[model samples]
Target: MTGRRVRVAVTGMGVKCPAGNDPEDVFRRVLHARPTAAVVPGLAEAGLPVRFACTVPEFDLAPYIGRREARQIDRATALLLCAADDAVAGAGGAVRGPGHRAGVHIGTGIGGLPGMEEVVYGHGERPMGMPVHTVPKSMANSPACRLAMRYGLRGSCMTYATACASGTNAIGEAARRIRDGELDVALTGGVDAAVTKVIVSGFARMRALSVRNEAPELASRPFDADRDGFVMGEGAAVLVLERWDLARRRGARIYGEVAGYATTCDGAHAVAPDPQGAMAAECMRLAIADARLTPAGIGHINAHGTSTVLNDLAEAVAVERCFGPQSPPVTAVKGVTGHLIGGSGAVEALVALLCAARGVVPPVATTASTPDVGALDVVLGAPRQVARRPVLSNSFGFGGQNACLVLRPAP
Candidate 1:
């Protein structure tokens, strides 16, 4: 424990994205610059503040999920479990045997909100009676439990709800557990299907959602001066993480190594990031240090670019402050995936892994010009192939919950 260097290998992967459900299809779609977001069916007629979202369409859940379990679980957990199958299967089915060797650390920002909102907002329903499976299913831990039960992972099954940072934190914590010798493999990622009527209205009230109703696909313009706010999006991403040695021993397909993880707090603002973004920079620095590297080692970054003005700027500033003018290629996925809220980081972390593995930088879409573009290498227009290896990924939440992860191509 004292001397052995810990390396977290991402062996399996799956994506339940708007463009596609299958991981392979989604990855190809992203590479080809396909659109995944559109106006949801029959929602615009209801006059919801946000009319469009990145939704998986023409898809039957039963084919990928069991009808009995799907009925009891929220869509968030359902998608997570579906994605988990591909992930563990990618891990070479080593999740078998004593469940204690495996764990589930899935993250979600809004747990059962659509279902919970239905029960609570239904004025016709009785005031006191709880839904048959309200508490357990609506709890944030539900996704973790459902994932664990679905995959027989009995160890460290839990959930983290750090707003948009939730998924990344869960994955980071899972990496820690494996590094600390608590588990050998983990199903790590995030899911959120909470883009509901009430949730959209809430964001509209706060003006945190893009009002590009007529131009839904062109919304979520991160780092652009004209960027208003992030468009709400929903999806699930899953990655099977294992100790590098174990993955190599099993001859599993490796995506990347979870080389470093660092989380910090500003404690300066309730919701807004510190304008200086010093603490955020430190998080990146600390992550690099944990990976036993320096700022110059990073070849790319997957930013927590929510398409919101402040967030994009703050993140850009933080990266520059941390890595100086030599900041590597920076890319924002929110523009394409929309903002998955709690699931943002974990899903984007996968984008980072892909960037390092495939040596292609994902382009930030619908973006115009950033004031600090000179400092940040914002990948745009097209996917750029670079000699990328270790990349930094960031996710900052409302309560100052910020987690940075350094991932590198599999050695």
Candidate 2:
């Protein structure tokens, strides 16, 4: 419907992750390569194979929402609500009124897993006293619906559930809608609170989770030669995207521009990525092209590095295929925050924007061993200074879902 798409500006961001709640604090922790993985409070007694995870520490919803309202929602919804509150506030409360065409788009892998596990598996035969709001809270669209209701966003309220790529896809889709002039403002991000016994045990049984119980903080070594598997992490991240002109008119503090976005499917496997990473490479190239940029234009890459042997190798190959021997410097936030599953992409997107604005790249905290893929320059140990340019953030998920976003520094 257009020749050149409208630019979407990122005006506000909020994060509730293992690293921290504030965006700046989280980025600082990531820059320093601080690891937050630790043993879950009750996992050891629960007898699960994997006992550790990167959990949001001491999160309380009372400050953001009333106690009565918080009681009806699940942990995932609570996290999203908290992040959304911060994001909306940070955006100077511009999208709240009924006059604006606002929307809510959220991504989540398994929404309300804790509630589902409790009501479904916890109650054996004691006449399960399910709460009235259990069904609503346990639904996969709970977070998105709750956010929309809270903000009074009247436009399309949608939810994406592409396993781990949920958050990135949500942000990309929302940006597209705004760029296409379908919406004036949007709250888009990813959130997941699935560090439950069922999820952890399932991953452990599949040999997809790290088994380093003694030293959980050092367990998630993405792209490292000695890396075994990813450690589960739970968190939420939300960003406020607005039409560039609207943001400028309002004098909003622009963090960056969502220049281009692309989503692709491997169509090769249900759980494992194609070792060749052909589709993944194509996705990256498509996103860069959509942004009117070339491979050489991208300054850095925030890899979808899950610490799993298969994912890291596949992603590395994809990067090499996309940019050849001159691949951009790469960093994996999973090393510090662990694998946030659906929320990882959104948080990493924020990190990429910060990197571009600050002219530096953070390190992959635990990746000390030689990188399995020697062709790529994986940032490690210390932050690397670089010129501000477009940053490519990647998110690949189960069932071969891949999403990429090209974020350009604000002019």
Candidate 3:
């Protein structure tokens, strides 16, 4: 790991998403474009205009950690801990080799809004008397702090909160550190458990939520004619990253290599992407160049198709501009997973790695008729078997934050 072209291997991945609880299950659902959005419990009675969201069902944290321990942490932290456990276990156990050389990186857009809401609203009347663990639970750095404590990682424990781009930035930064020889291993990803009424009400008030209460499953139809808005989702995804040479020496099961990562900002809008997509396309170009590969080397794209008109269209224009008319096959996992906000990028990166491992492209879950945004190839109906090549995943967040990563099959 000497030059800027140092390779970072994705040895293992662990994901808890709306599509499924495990990586394999999630990939299967992704390939077929299965919809997972459903009415959130109590959302209908809560009087919020938006009623549906993609919620993880009854995640049992018992096997991963004790009940008492789970009670102390936030739901976002709990999800990250579970995903990290799976990731570490998949990579052949805990940090037995040079814990000081390892690190933790996680991203969350809203941190522990669910916990804060419960503490504030559940036990009313006493606004001043909050729980002692409130700050610990609600802070954005809790996941990273808890992960570092859990695995004894002493190097660079950090958290990025760039809205939906948080996860992508976390993974990118981790890969960059390892590539630059700052660390040998990093447990990096993102998580968000912000499906609370406080969170839901805010989005609903902004009118950014879908009002398809009767048809929750069809609410998140990205790149579709009838698409209204994105469906909020909750989940976590963590990837085990190591130096490519080290991974090979250890005989770790390498899924793919984090070949390149780049981030840019539109600097034009607070919540909407640039209609021209110049900045987004430039970000993609920079990521491709960082990988030391041309755009022709890419075989597929995991897009940030959040089902919203602004995001979907802007992303489409960007993809088309970057790769020209014959763009690589593109798929939006959000149609099924909904928009996981901070967790979306890591999960999409996992999807890209899985595609490289399996050589199959997933479909854009809910779009029966593709929107007339651009001519880029949008995988639909069913999964496409591809001749394994490099894949690029994109994530754009509010405040004009944009991040892109290029992933190549492990050599």
Candidate 4:
């Protein structure tokens, strides 16, 4: 299967987000420029420092998930399961092929924190006082394994843990497998339910949190001059990537084609983005080249805008250096969704794919006006309708991990 142009295409997608628990709903909300992040319920009463999060409100996954399965799988994994179910459903149920031809690749920032905390409280300092489900729930790959097992996917199954880039890494890796003929189809995404106090306190300790108790909904202001650190978010997004030939053979609807992917390491700082943005620029360059296209061909960019001061600044520099002046339309969804961390990239994938398919660029639902920092056509205030071309989705994570993927409307 090596060097054999496997023709990767996006067949389906599902998302559980503040705007909506379903992809259509999320698309509609984003298209209309709605804000979802708010003061998380119960956080104020708990006396926590940070107050806002992009919480999934009134999500009844029971309608989509089984009861027995719901009881054991961690909420993080459960979120992935629910999203994967939606994607597979969008693909018209399962593929009519060998189960081994399908695969699962999941990413999670902090897997099973809810269940692990439960175990810690339920069992004290005694040795080996872990529940049977503890190990499975705590494993970062638990969602990937469970998705593969449930779907009977025997093809390559794996998970990535590259912090914020985890989900993007999973999606990129899945596309790689499809491109290499390792699998005909794959379900890949990222999930996180790690809005725990520990996670919050840790970020707060680093002073990387938006202390906007007054206006929680307006806390996440990506690319805004007055932006603070990112607000934590929770949810999951899954996508079905199928070989274009197989999708055509099955008469499947294609959302977009994954044209290229690139992943790189900064090797500079463990927690901070490079001031020069060299690694980030190189990453985008590599992805654009991998797609066999020049940066001039890209029409839109779904940036890894986490709302942090350094991140937005560095990312803007990278995009400018890579695309030059009069760059593509860029919209940073984290302004509205907050920073979902690991799941951010996959959710951004949903936005980018839709941009490529529908020929419309969603607006940046920011609290304040977007800063005029770079040479980008930053979409704001209103959605833009234009001919959608290749869209680049960027993801940069902790430990200086950078990834970019180019997707185009499936022809």
- The models' CA-based lDDT, in order, is 0.81, 0.90, 0.87, 0.83
- Provide C-alpha RMSD values for all models, in order: 1.9, 1.4, 1.6, 2.0
lDDT per residue (tens digit) for residues 1-411 in model 1: 157776788988877767567766766666655555688754587797778877754567776787677767787877787777767766676686468989989888787777788778763378567657777777888888878877678889878888888888988999999999899988889888877888878878878788878888888777877887888887888888888888888777888889999999888877788877899999999999998889888888888988777778888889889989878888887777788887777778877788787888877777767775458888778888888688889999877778999999875
Model 2, backbone clash pairs (residues 3+ apart or across chains), number: 0
Which of 2 and 3 is ahead in lDDT?
A: 2
- On TM-score, the stronger of 3 and 4 is 3
What's model 3's overall lDDT? 0.87
- Collision pairs in model 3: none
Best by lDDT: 2
Stretches of candidate 1 off by over 4 Å are: 127-130, 372-374
Per residue, candidate 3 scores C-alpha lDDT tens digits across 255-364 of 98999899999998888899889899999999999898899999899999898888888998999889998889988889998889899999999998889767898878
Residue 203's lDDT in candidate 3: 82
Candidate 2, residues 274-341: lDDT per residue as tens digits? Answer: 89999999999999999999999999999999999999999999999999987899999999999888
TM per candidate comes to: 0.95, 0.97, 0.97, 0.95
Locate the minimum summed-lDDT window of 10 residues in model 4.
367-376
